[model samples]
Target: MFARRRPCRRPSPDLRCRPSGRATFAAFAVAVTLLPSLAQAQCGGSFSGFVRGLKDEALAAGYGAATVNSFFNGAAQDPKVLKADRAQGVFQKPFVEFSRRLISNDRIQRGARKSQELNKVFHRIETTYGIDRGVLLAFWAFETDYGAFQGDFNTRNALLTLAHDCRRPDLFRPQVFSALELYARGGFDPARTTGAWAGEIGMVQMLPGDILENGVDADGDGKVSLKTSAPDALMSAAKMLSHLGWQPNQPWLQEVTIPADLDLEETGLLHRKSVADWQADGVRAKSGSFALRKGPAALILPQGHKGPAFIAYPNFDVYFEWNQSFTYVLTAAYFATRLEGASVYDAGRPDAGLSGGEMKQLQKKLQARGHDVGKVDGILGAKTRLAVQKEQARLGLPADAWPTPALLKRL
Candidate 1:
């Protein structure tokens, strides 16, 4: 089993790890050119070349040869897809800023309206899937801003590029095959299979494999169309969440106040703990209420000791499992609040986020300082923050895992 790391205690500083310098870019360019040859040797031929392999596997898995071949015949490597994949601005901004951009007023308002408009559909989905309608609406908003910007990138092309790229072959190769399976099932025409640069499809931008596994035709049109059908998309998303272990009628997260002397190391909800157990340790609702009556929740310090604290439930982790980004999950929860007619987060605290270039530089510096900051990828995950904390402790700085201009100067 893959070991899950703890969530970030605080919002990541602007200067987390990023991809190495231009040399790395040049190397990537070379790798992309050689990817097809490498893939042919490993799994044989290009994506189309893998057809026979897929056929054998599909037959073993109870699929017919005609079904497998029909799907693979339409699969081809798309150069524009590869170009977009290479052009991604990974680790381009701080998590806080990224979250802010995604959880905008337009998204909130649209989500609220969409929630109201789709009340019956939402209720039916909730009843059938055990996932809340507001949460589903929030996901819809967060992913594509209520379909205002469902990407036009051809998903088959993107998946082919990634599968050929080899850096993450283990992850993407299966997805490529799954997309073929989806095509064979007539979920969507291969010509119209478009989505994000990474091949996530529809309003919620689900991966092809995910769609194949969890998609539902809620409208009963005899088709599962995530692009044109809001009901189908929303129900499919709720089903995905339910499969991911979403608990019905449970809070995803709650703003909370932690005691001044609480141990940061002991802050996570790895094991189930009662709300009363947390209140006994002086944790209180952010609403300033002492009444500690609620369901099980795990404490999350998104910005360590200084930033906002939250009592995140298992449902919150369900959101994280969707994207594996702390900020992404937070934005989903915040958007859900707006769908439920709650106020937006008050920006009383002032912390300017870092730009894309600054984040890249910081990640390089952290890696140079001997921290196991993975890949210098601009996104700050738990590994990157732990590395930052180690360096901060060494420099006698606050081990809060927040990056600052002063820290950059020190580097």
Candidate 2:
């Protein structure tokens, strides 16, 4: 297995590495059209043609032709990256498994130490940005394991491959141009620059477009180097989140207890009701009560009724800008809670969900029976939850809204 990376809101930049013998995909970049020595050499066919087209687009966008061609020349297809592009995981592990791997004892310990060591920086960011330090730390650790292992792919090469592969060209194309745009502004070189497979760069794994638009010069050296500067990366991340409407001091979520007899329809994020409404619904606050955020919240049964339940709030939407997965956001929130000195989930997670492949099969079965669970991407999401609930009700099983092998067999 390879270390997991992010997939952003727009196919924009969920790029990262894969562990298969020959699997990897990363993307989006900028211009390349120098003094036109060999337009014939640079503009051939296949990905080469695509690269030339990208160059023209960049030039039309006001980038220097010399800058564009310098980056585009000798850009060849990366089959490994293409293989990785096609191999995006269709199934997802359960919250329990996913959380365990993402936030282990060692990770928690590191977070604690980082919080202690980076107090001034975190404090500065929070005081200025009104964001929680713990949440920022979670983003940092999750993105590159605290910058321990950012990928080494040539971002331009990776973006080049993804852009030409014909799999979501609309998404990767802009990203490639953005990366080139970033290079045009200087400091970034196509050869020296590298990052996640999808061309995500920096400690916080901000996409190139995001970096260009939202990156901060936290270090104030007159240059923004997310790959090398911590202050710059962290501050940039906080700024991006703030721009995305991160509620200052509002909890991303809180662990809670749902009564066994509670109405199932009231659960899920869409049924957002105030805390008082949830209290009326018999949801008990197992975690510390939300003193500041007392209003609108939604009950999220990430691992179902048997596992830990959380009350998510508006600020939780910021997590979507980082990743679209519910489990990932929950994991990040839980990790931040731990960094803030909170205990592990009192309810703990259940070990009953189906594995990735099993979930994919279950998704297929559900699709066969006519439940549109979206791309059948096995990481059971909202549509899958509704589908599972419908199936459970149809089979006269309790609509717990979680996947299980037994349920699959019954289907």
Best by TM-score: 2
TM-score of each: 0.76, 0.86
Estimate, for each residue in 82-135, the C-alpha lDDT of model 2 and write its tens digit: 677657562276677777878878877888888787788889888888888889
User: For every model in order, what is the number of clashing pairs?
Assistant: 15, 23
Best candidate per lDDT, number? 2
Q: After superposing candidate 2, which stretches have Cα over 4 Å from the reference?
A: 1-45, 86-91, 291-293, 347-351
For model 1, state the Cα shift of residue 207 in Å.
2.3
Error of 2 at 16 (Å): 26
- lDDT per residue (tens digit) for residues 21-51 in model 1: 2222123223333556423324335655555
